[model samples]
Target: MMQLQAEDFGSWDNPALDRATWMDIGDNCGELDVAIHRAAARGDVAELSRLLDTPHDINARCSSENSALHWAIVADKTEAVRFLLSRGADPSLRGRGGSDGREGDDAALCAARFERVSVMEVLIASGVGIYSETLGFAVISKNMDMIRLLVGTMRYDFTDMPRLQALEGILPAAVRTWSLESVQYLMEELKYDASTISTNNQGVLNLALLAIFNQEDVHDQLVETESDKDWGVAIQIIQLLVAAGASVNAVDDWVARTPLHFALQLQYPPSELIDYLLVHNADVNVPNHMGRTPFFQLLTRSDATEEMVRRFQRLGGSLDVMDDEKNTPLHLVKRPEIASLLLVSGADPASKNKYGQTPLHQASCVGDIGVIAQLLDYGADIEAKDSSGQTPLLAAMSYARCSGFWEKDTRTINFLLERGANVAAFNRDGQSATQLIDLKGYHINNLGKLALKVGHHVRQTQDNREEENVVDLW
Candidate 1:
């Protein structure tokens, strides 16, 4: 074996050697140095072995402070990694010499980054210290086995705040990936408390529910079998967490929303999970930060189902409960089924929100004839005025121009007219329904024209009745 001079190894300041680094290296290195870097990176065991025996510096630092072992591990070259470890390579060496003074990649960290469990084992066996960030990397890769090896077998301190933070950070990803086994290992075997681990200040249940909700949105559009698999995993994880004693009513600190609230807000809400949580004694009427209960949240979704409303009612959820805005569940009703369910459950249709708007007022705004009719059937005040002094008739006309559904809006206006909605009523702005229509420049179609004519006739008939009463009294 021929021994090379120190000068032949090249100075660290030499741009050729400096530019041939791994991640931090620029593409300005000489071809020879680049070839050497490539050989180590690609894990060409024979070539690396031949080069190593030539008195070349095995621990030569690249521009980014990465050594041959770091490159080998990053490339996932298990054989080259083993060979280098056996050849007295320092597994603990970190990359250095960057402008920002940032530490370079170590062998263990590199192995964890690429999720090479075998290489990680070899590095750990070589007495390399595992950083908290290494565990986070494994979690990021969703490698349950790697996580077990690091925390369970390697005995990395799980009590450390960084490790705990890493665990918390990965909970959402675990839920998103539907990694029930990994979640179970973290919660059960590792004793990670699901209640304590939150993503964005939301507990594990909240995170799981949000994940399910998002997956449901995608599941609705997908026609394949795999679409349901993710949702199924989410459901299982929710069940697993509950069975493991996770708090079903754990409220998100930011929104004060429980898992049930999230479940209700989904486009295709999961009834099974809702029922499961309720069975576990999750509060059916727990008020969120805005004072809205799960029932209130349910009414906000356009696809609120009759079965969901019935489930809540069966669970003893109160329909008349009001939020901070004083809006009852009935005030937010967008679907006829929801309205009907509330009515059957003894909800007050005439209930006024903080805005003094009744359920009928809200129904009129949306031009939902079914909900409007149901509210009326339940004795909702069609002429009821809100705090703004706007009646349901005026409310319907005011909102009609902005609703974009001209036909639906016209039908709602005409329905209110035929049902004796007082179109002559004025709001607090001193604006009557007809005045508002003209002020807003609403283009009323033929149906709106008929409604106006019928409204005028009704008002005239009322005036005539008053005159007749006065003559009789005289």
Candidate 2:
């Protein structure tokens, strides 16, 4: 073998960065760190290694204050995360990386929220902080396997009383997620306090009830079938909380309304849960801080069916009940089905709110032709006026602008006109029905500037290519 001179080996043999190159990287490290972020985000571990192997700190953050480890976590690049961790990326250092509409700031916590199990496993193994908040985020994800990984891991033991105590705050999240598995794990297995009030001073059980509306609002997730929905998940969640000492009759600090109040008031409230709450002594008539009872609050819901109204009345939820504004259930009802139920069940259609707005006026203002017809049939004065001196016809025109500007609003106006509703009537605002309608048309026209907000766009002609003339919605 030939003996190699140190001079020959100086720049080419060892193959590490020279002193000046190291200094140069340190000087322009911010720009290079973005390259590292881009590489990690793309999961190009080969490029990641090449960047980190440069003469600089492995934990160097990019321009956005996120480290390469954060970009890897953001992109769900599990292998890249592992490679970064192995290459000395600080797992303990919180990465301020977050995606659009993603909830948390900590990358590991966001991982738990999104149920990125493999990514979370790599993070946990690399000694990421077992934040108690992260535990709640894990529960919110409703992923049993992810929950198992966190609590079952050696470093993050639920059996550790301190950790268990720290996790007590996770009950609200468990309730909100409606995850029966999480409920059982936290309440049954770990004994997290189900009776614990939330930060808003609301009962944990009430949050479980309110989350029914919340879960329905998540449009991205595919709707699960009833059988596949973990067998009446809402009712089961309520049952678990109640069984764990949560009070079905408990009142919130803000509303002073019990869990029964939520079950009755919200749209599409679980019927089985309502039955469960009532059977367990949930008082539907208990007054909230707003001076409204559960029955009164129930009236405001647009989804209450005719059968539900009759059933509620039979179970002591009286249609005779009135809100703080003195509006009877008949006045508050928006659906024709519920209005007919109340009218037939002896609710006076002539009832008025504190503002002297009669039920006919209420129906007209909401542009509900069915409700207006129901009220008229039930002896409601067709020409009734509110305190504002607006007749039913005038009321329809004044509020028709808020009718979501749909064709049904004009149909309601025509319906009233056909039923002897005077178009000559004027309000205290000195605006006649025709004048108000003209103003509404002008408003709709100006909505062109806010087309996105109004959700209005001219449809195409029959050919479906070129833009057609704007249809006069008014």
Candidate 3:
């Protein structure tokens, strides 16, 4: 005899049959009833019929508290399900020990989960309560038929705030599953407010942005490929929501990021989509919770394009907008091309961030020699001191020393020196650039040697100038 075990459940939360229930049932149940449970799970109509001929507990729950009807529905045993229902099996009885546990799911939920529409009809006709959680499961499953059955037949109040909240909980899942039809039904038929913000303060627009962001992250992990079907669905959903009056300016309550902020951060943001939002009057300069404008966010992305940057500019994005750190678009420049574009667009090269660090100071920290050169060409202060009193040259040397990328560091250091960085200047800690390098145990590199010689000459010149001033004073 092949005895069934929990592993036979296959992907079900509770794999093993409940031993205690089995033991109790085995002591009382006849061999025929046991065979009936097995027959129901396997969808053996003939075996079920043979067992049904004799007296049996039609709604007999097994060790897991799952009646034979639950088993039939879970296994998509349509015929067996009909027979069990005809025999007065209780469809409303909840399954006890599955993944969701005793209070989690009923036969209706199992039918919906497995997409057993016929079985679902039987359960619904038998008067099962469609709870909000059940609706959530259906929404997340993206089974339009099940969702329709629950909403249309069961008369679930889609206008109820609790139900709308439930729908919100599954928005991400719906997007992932490409449940466009289900979303349309909710928005069009139920008149669910597409712009209504959820308890988390995210509206449909914000959710769509989050979906695109997640898709981009997934794209990063996978090899480049063709446009995903889900991407198409996402674009369509955004279009549908926008046409239905979803706000393009909807900001998340927590991060306060408008949809525009997310659109610009996409790895390969669709130009048309961006333009659509802009045409709809999406604010390009609205700051988020971090006080970062969409333009500021764009600078943080290495993939930002000249055309994208230009579009924001033409739409009145301020080049000098500062983030919470007071870093302007120029201060956050990661690419030389972006730096050039910003400078041409009137970004002040000498503008300092909250930390008093100039664009040149930022370029040094990232070892972008090209951006450093570009800023200097535009007359950025080479010897500007940040709040810590570390000049651009000192910033470059400190970053290089800590980063362990000696070659790039050496190139950046040598570049700064040739561009008139003051090597003898001391930071707030009273440590000159050479002294800082010595503290890092790397006082003998090419840049270090140059700094020492330059420091001696600059210090001597400073002394001479001071003496000249003293004689004048006397």
- TM-score per candidate, chains pooled: 0.73, 0.58, 0.75
Model 1: per-residue Cα lDDT over 149-210, one tens digit each: 87667754442345555565566566665677877777654354545654543454455444
Off by over 4 Å in 2: 1-91, 96-129, 141-146, 152-161, 192-231, 250-270, 287-292, 297-303, 335-346, 400-426, 429-474
Sorted on TM-score, best first, the list reads 3, 1, 2
Candidate 3 TM-score, C-alpha based: 0.75
Pick the winner on lDDT between candidates 2 and 3: 3
lDDT of 3 at 87: 76
Model 2, span 1-474: residue lDDT tens: 121122321232222213223112223432334567768767899998887678756677765455777667655789998998888787556543334543323556646644567888987787766566667656755677777777766356432245655445566667666677777776654553546644433344455544443333222221433333432776787776666566677775545666676556544556776778778877667776666777776666777666665666667876667777787877777788777777777889777889989988888877788889888877888778888888887877777666586576777766775566654577897776656655565222222323412332332123322334222322
Question: Could you tell me which residue pairs clash in candidate 1?
Answer: 95-104
lDDT of each: 0.66, 0.63, 0.67
